[model samples]
Structure formats: structure tokens, C-alpha cells
Target: MNTIPVRVVAAEVIAEGIRLLKLSSQDGSPLPTWEPGSHIDVHLDPGVIRQYSLCGSCTDTSTYEIAVKREPESRGGSKFVHESLGVGSQLSISAPRNHFTTSTEADHNLLVAGGIGITPIISMARQFHRQDRAFELLYFTRSETHTAFRDELASGPLNSSCRLLFGLERDAVEATLDDALRNRHDGSHLYLCGPQPFMDTVRAVAARHGWPDDAVHLEYFAAAAPLDAEPQTSFDVRLARSEKTFTIPADKTIVDVLREHGTDVETSCEQGVCGTCIVKVLEGCPDHRDYFLTAQEHAKGDCMAMCVSRSLTKLLVVDL
Candidate 1:
């Protein structure tokens, strides 16, 4: 992944435990254009990188904006951004990459955002509003104070079509979702981002309502759960191009083994939420442990996230 140095032009707290950052190129050049749902890999420190969605205007090239929510149990990235990074701080970031892209073919778009997951959904809302497209936004939060971009959602163009569902009981939220799903317009597409539990609820509701797999899109704020829950066994990986074979221990990752063999693979979010470490699989089936790929993509068995994913077969061949 190619990276460019950027300076933090603005950094301020937007909501409880959330900070909004505005970044621009150091040379004062227009940054690369990115579509809604695109994210950049922020290099917080050596061996510390995190993926943040680009929440700013897609058409704007002056600066790229992202919202970072400090995780209490964070492994360091969010904590670093919230406490160490400030205006004028220099940072390096990878070019924008989109794993969760919006569908322009839908006649209507339904956006559901929970907690800090509002970042990407709000970007999509802005794009839809810009094109004068038919859409509605349902934002769920614990309270008004916890809602990020509250002012923007209320005063911005999306306000008219946005519904703020704050401090609602679980049953109430379910009812609201049920009603929305019941009244979903024809040719409408659903986009959702939130905590794993929230997303799972929305996905289950959508599936029960007969929404097709392709019609419903999802973005995870973090790994759903621990990726090492299942027992792992040793496996052999053969690099098709390099013609080098390496043994990946049950406790070690493919990326670690590859790097040990002098193969440096570009990787971010080593936990597998980011798609940065994806590589082609020339032969054998991958375990498909990453949250970045869709079910269809995983079923194809042609690509794998080398960071945390492993081979299901005894010997896997990859196109280094």
C-alpha cells in the first residue's frame, strides 16, 4: 500500500468518546478523490495501524475527514488518536480503499447507523442527498449526547429525511426496524454499520423480511468477536511465484510466517477487519476468517486475508 504524509488540520471532540479529525496533504495539493464507504489506513505508530472510514464529502479534495471513537479496550490506535494526535500533528495514511461500496442502481436507499458506525452511513447519506436520490436514515444511539455529528444531522441536508432514535428500549428499536422493513419501498437497498450485535440484529431482521443478500450491505466497526475462538492446526503454505514453502504454526499467522521468510506483505488491521492484506489463492481453500469479504467473495475461494486467515487444506498455494 502506498502512503502519503498528511498533517492534521483540525481535531476536536464531536461526541462522548468520539473525536473528529480533518486531514490534508502536506504539500497543499488536492487529495485523491474517494467514494462513499471508502476508508484510509491511519498509521498511528510503528506497527500500529487502524482503518477509519472517510466521512467527509466525496467530491471535496481539500481534506479528508474521519471520526474516531475511543475504545475502552483499544489495543492503542484509537487511544493514540484521541490522546496523542492533535492539530498540526503529522501522520501518514494509505490511499483510500473501498471494501464497502454503495449501490447506485437502487431506486431508494435505506441507511441504518448505530453508535459511531454513523461515519460511513452519513457519507452515504450525503452522496444520496447530493444526487437528490430517495433515501431515509435511521440513526440509533444511547442518548442525544452520545450521537456523533448530531448538529450536522439536524442542520444538514439529511436532517429532513433522518430519524433520530435515541434512548429507546430494545423492543422499541426492534419495532421501529420492523415498521421500516415492512414499509420498505420496491428496488430499495439497505446499508448498515454499527456494533456487531446491532448489525447482526439488523441483518437478521432484513433477512427475515425477504431482503436479498446483495440488497443488504454491512460494515463492521470492529471484529465481531475473537477470531481465535476455534482451535487452529499447523498448515503449510506454498508461494506459487516464489516457489517457497513455509510452515504456519497453529498459534502464528500467515503474515508472520511470510515476513519471517523475507516476504513483506502490506497489511493493516492485522486482526482482519481491513482488506489491506488480501492476496490471491492459486490453489486450495482458505479458512475465510476476515470480516472484510462478503459471503460471495469467500465462497469463491480465490482470495484470502493473509493477516489472520489461514488455509483449510494441508497445503495451500498462493500467488505471492
Candidate 2:
């Protein structure tokens, strides 16, 4: 991935525990344009890279904006952004990549976001609004105190299309979901992002409402399921390009083994959520542990995330 050198032009708390950052190219040039649902990998320090959605305007090429919510249990990304990163801070970021993208082809879009998940959904909303497309945004937060972009979503033009539900109880939430998803439209699609449990609930409810799997989309900021669910085992991996073979122990991941042997493998969010370390598999069955790939992709058995996925075969061949 190509890295862009940027400087923070503005930084301030957008809501309780949420900090918004505006970044611009250091050379006074226009930043690359990105589609909605795109994210940039922010490099905080050596070996400390985290992905954040581009929540700012796509038409605005001068600056890119991202919102980071302080997560106490995060893998150090959110904490550092909230406490250490500020205006004038220089950082390196990867070109924007989109894994969760919105489509204008859909007759109507249902956008559901929980807390910080609003970052991507808000971008989609902006794009849809600009195009005069049909979209309804459902934003849920603790309360107004914790609601980022409250005034923007509350604008007269968007008031009729967006719903802000604050501190709703479980029953209320379920009822609202039922009412919102009761009827399925011909070309309607649902985009969801939020805490794992929250997304799971939304998916379950959508499934119960007869929404097709292809019509519902989501993105994960971290691993959804625990990788430890499977028992560890030792295996051997061979690189198809170099014809090099290495033995992987039960305690070490493929990435660890490869790097230890001086073979470098790029990785981020080693927990299998980012899909950054995904490589093509030449020949082998893999014990898939990543949420980045779809179920259909897992069934193909042509690739795996080296960071967390293991080989089901004793001898695995990979296209390194």
C-alpha cells in the first residue's frame, strides 16, 4: 500500500469520548478522493497502525476527516488518538481502501449505526444526500451528550430522513427495528456498523425479518469471534514463490514464524479483522479464523489471513 504523509490541520472533541481529526497532505496538494465507506490506515508510530473510516466530504479534496472514540479495551489505537494525537501532528496514512461500499443502484438504503460506527454510515449519508438518493439513517447513541454530528444530522433537509434514538431500552430497540425492517423493498439494502454484539443483534433481527444475506452488509473494527475457539496445532507452510518451507508451532502464528525466519509479511490488526495480511493459498485447507472474508470466500479455500488463520493440512503451500 502507498503511504501518504499528512499533517493534522484540526483536532477537537466532537462528542463525549470522541475526538475528530482533520488531516491534509503535507505538500499542500489535493488528497486522493475516496468513495463512501472507505478507510485509511493511520500510522501512529512504528508498528502501531490502526484503521479509521473517512467521515469527511468526498468533494473536499483538501482535507480528510476521521472520528475516533476512546475505547478503553482497544488495541491501543483509539487511546493514542484521543490522548496523544492533536493538531499539527505529522503522521503517515495509507491510501483509502474500501471494503464496505455503498451502491447507488439500490432503490433505497437503510443505514443503521451505533456509536462510533456512525463514522462510515455518516459518509454514506452525505453522499446519498448529495446525489438526492433515497436513504434513511438510524443513529443510536447514549444520549445527545454522546452524539457526534448531532447538529448536522438534525439539519432541516435531513431531519425528515434521519432518526435519532437516544438511550433506547432493549424492547424499544427491537420494536424500532421491527417497524423499520418489517417490509422489504425490491431494491433496498441494509448497511450496519457498530459494536459486535449490537451488529449481531441487528443481523439476527434482519434475518428473522426475511432479509437476504446479500442485502445486509457490515464492517468490523475488531475480531468478532475469538480465535482461541480452535485448539492449536503445529504445521508446515511452503512458499510457492521461493519454494521455501517452514514449520509453524502451535504457540506461534504463520506471520510470527515467517518474520522470525527473515521473510517479511505485512500485517495490521493481527486479530484477523482488517484483512491486511490476507495472502493467496496455493494448496491447502485452512482453519479460517478471520471475519474479513465472507463465508463464500472461506468455502473457496484459495486464501487466508496469515496473522490468525491456521493450516488444516499438515503441509500447506502459499503464494507468498
Poorly placed runs, candidate 2 (over 4 Å): none
User: What lDDT score belongs to each candidate, Candidate 1 first?
Assistant: 0.90, 0.89
Flag clash pairs in model 2: none
TM-score of each: 0.93, 0.92
Q: Report the error of model 2 at residue 320, Å.
A: 3.6
Runs off by more than 4 Å, candidate 1: 183-186
The backbone clash count of each candidate, in order, is: 0, 0
lDDT of 1: 0.90
lDDT of 2 by residue, 184-271 (tens): 8878999999888888878888989988877888888887678868999999999999999999999999999999999999876788
* Candidate 1 lDDT, 167-276, residue by residue in tens: 88878888889888876666999999998888888887887898888889888867878887888999999999979999999999999998888899988678788787
Query: Which ten contiguous residues of candidate 1 have the minimum total lDDT?
Result: 267-276
